[model samples]
Target: MSTWMIYGANGYTGELIARQAVRDGMAPVLAGRNEEAISKLAGELGLESSVFSLDDPATVAEKLQGMELVLHCAGPFSKTSRQMVEGCLTAGAHYLDITGEIGVFEMIHAPETSKRAADKGVVLCPGVGFDVIPTDCTAHKLKELMPNAVSLSLGFSFLAGMSPGTTKTMIEGLSGGSAERKDGKIVPFPMGSKKRTLDFGKGQQPVTAIPWGDVSTAYYTTKIPNITTWIPLSERQIRGARVMSLFAPVLGTKPVQNQLLKWVDRSVKGPDERARENALSYIVGEAKAEDGRTVTVRIKTTNAYTLTALGSLEVVRRMLGRDLPSGSFTPAGLFGSGLVESLEGSGKFEVVE
Candidate 1:
């Protein structure tokens, strides 16, 4: 009987989460800035609705009063996360979002907010979506095997294309260059600076270093001083990254970036159910202890979008089942790989000793 709020409930992924929650016979308050869309979705789902913008942090905080949990599905979370997090803290409601932005990880994990969440005694867990849930779990499992691990590496294969929200977020990161954690410090590198041929058990495929949220979260979760996250990329993508690195100065321009985004419809959604069901994802995490002991773990899961729904809801379900105090946590750090293993279409493969 845990109550939840579905923020950005009309957006592509938010819509999916809302539908799945309803399909599973769970009730969540549907909320967003668009009155017409949220109202339509609320009506369709037979749920209550809230329409408000994050323009005023105080007002946004006021609306969060009494909300037990808020599944923030809106993005670019870079722009949205801080406001909602402040609101969640104000209301003493646990905060969770589907953001994979490195900046976001740094923001929520900031000692200031972390302290606030601790004082409020409400949990602050972001990236509950496919962003880092499975991979965070994978890294956690690897760290367990190599307790003194000083370095953590994680990589994943894309299971599907981006939603409009995701596409927008990617555009925002284009000029920022890629980032990673080195010696407990956030460092930048040129796009695709590191490449590896990882075997996902299927075969060896190319993975190029990318600035994923895990670079930020893993250090917090495991205190691993050095971390790098990678993503499978095609030859064409690797080439494009090189080109982008050279042209970042031009592409970073707001006017130029805005034009690029024009081709993608912000109102347009992500993949449909058929695409989600058919898609597949793979994640591998490796950690090296100071003593040279290393452990690698692999996970195969269903569609990225689909897992976002299933994994996030399962997180909420487990939260409702317990009396978790407020504090910052990664999904796996809080619930462990048991959360990931419990999912129907996901699990860890044999550990690499």
Candidate 2:
């Protein structure tokens, strides 16, 4: 039996990870609810696979026996993570997911969930993908530079199309509005409620506050009491987001979400090989101390999805080979500030004056 599995092996991001794993010569059991797609991918990759769904925890647990870890790729994880997590706990398998959902991070990090994972000798780490890994590491590095930092801001800009999973997650998150960590508590604000101008290696561009996973995971990784996340967007996109906020409630309804998700399934195709090869992503982080001093750092990396595939595999391989203390952790918290730098195709973190 393979010690690890990649659930959702047929999804866009999942398929990327699966192909990457094969290229890297690591064989992991591919698993998902879609037997046809999963079997096809498994055959193409010449790796073992199993078909299963997350509907029943007990059944999933039984199926997960003998697996040392699961790199969950299915999303919006807000709807799929709970059952899989429960199954991991029962089966004593470490849990990892490429989820960016704020609520999902909070839920897995909750006292009860952490305690259960600890008791079961399991590790629960979420946002191990592009969702939070780079930002979390940047926050950790800045905190090290400004030990007395009281405020932290992180931002990123990526040039790539969204996968169906990513698009559906965005649709579901529409109702939650934007969020930030203020004084160590998650606070909600209206969508596009805040904006600023920042230079993410490029010239100064207008950026708006968005509810990113770092808002939830950064506080844990850096112990920064105040944290905010941003992404560059044009005035038109900002205005459109503000307009959508007015209808957030109706959009959040199940029927509306279902319809929007159907549309996503029909139209959303993730970036292709050429796009992924040509695209790049940039991230910036700043830490402010009470004495009016600040430290800023910027990072350049490969395409977002590519980074996720490589980064998640590195984490998985290490966790499997080493004996990390059993509990929940943010990516940087588990690995260290150098986590992102250790991955291939990642650039050095340049300190800015």
Candidate 3:
């Protein structure tokens, strides 16, 4: 009976996942660098807590001892994933994180990391949350509808403000530009590579091309050669992204990124339970094959934050109960898009005309 360990158990998304686990009658040990926050949550939930900085690999490895799997919620994962992953590998535990960063997905799926995790016999999965899970699963559904699909597009519209952790993750790569999958390889694109219209059973919405985790995860999940991801935004927002290209050089600077982060920190935190309950997010995936056959799938899920918690917890439960193959994997790659189908609330997907 291996118990789950939730590192970063004090953050917004992390705390949600911890509670979700408890609601399901699972006792997971809480761990993170913030002693006060983790202690308060642990005491409230009557669960054990361990405080350790990711900077200390030895300490991280030690705390992971006897854990079946780790739900890593701490992000700006561009900085923390590697250290935590290293710790997981060394500790012989599975690694699952709620990161939507394309770079982090690429990093974890790199050949070297995949080989190491395979050799260590531990599952290495990233973006098990709202960021990629819904899109990844819809891509999988489209694959079944259009086998041999060569090109895929995913568009999503989230009607919610940024979670503090999510906002920080975005700031971390503010100037990295965008990306797309070409011939099954990740390629860098400028800030606003392209824009298009998507119909999510609702009215039409303008979606702009951006470097989303699906750029990396979908390629591995479906081996699709050409894939693009989009997020719905107003015309003004699209124009804003285009204008950003001109400022890429400046916006990418550490100082500028830091200042932007400070502004975000001062502005707002994340959604509250009511907000999470009220938010509605929609995703559309269109898959096309060389012969011109095409299929489109639309998915609806509730509360981005809540989706992250439920989706991640479900992945953890499966890992504990089943003998999943050890290697770097996206949600669809390991479990197929059906993982989304298993979502409890409004995590529903369907094909549309």
- For TM-score, the strongest prediction is 2
- Local accuracy of candidate 2 as per-residue lDDT tens digits, 148-178: 9999999998998999999999999888899
TM-score of 2: 0.98
Model 1: per-residue Cα lDDT over 1-353, one tens digit each: 66679899999999988998988889999999999999999998899999999999888988898788999999999899989998998887888899999999898888988888999888999998888888888888877788888898898886677899999888878888898899899999999667887777688788889899999998887888999998878778887887779877787898988887886673546787787888888888888888877778888888899889988898888786478866888898898866777777986566854
- Candidate 2 weakest ten by summed lDDT: 1-10
List where candidate 3 sits over 4 angstroms from the true fold: none
Q: Which runs of model 2 end up more than 4 angstroms from their true locations?
A: none
Whose lDDT is higher: candidate 1's or candidate 2's? 2
TM-score of 1: 0.96
Whole-structure CA lDDT of model 3? 0.87
Q: Residues 190-276, candidate 3, lDDT per residue (tens digit)? A: 776588999977888888888888999888888888999998888898888888787888888888888888988788678888877
The estimated TM-scores of all candidates read 0.96, 0.98, 0.96
RMSD of 1: 1.6
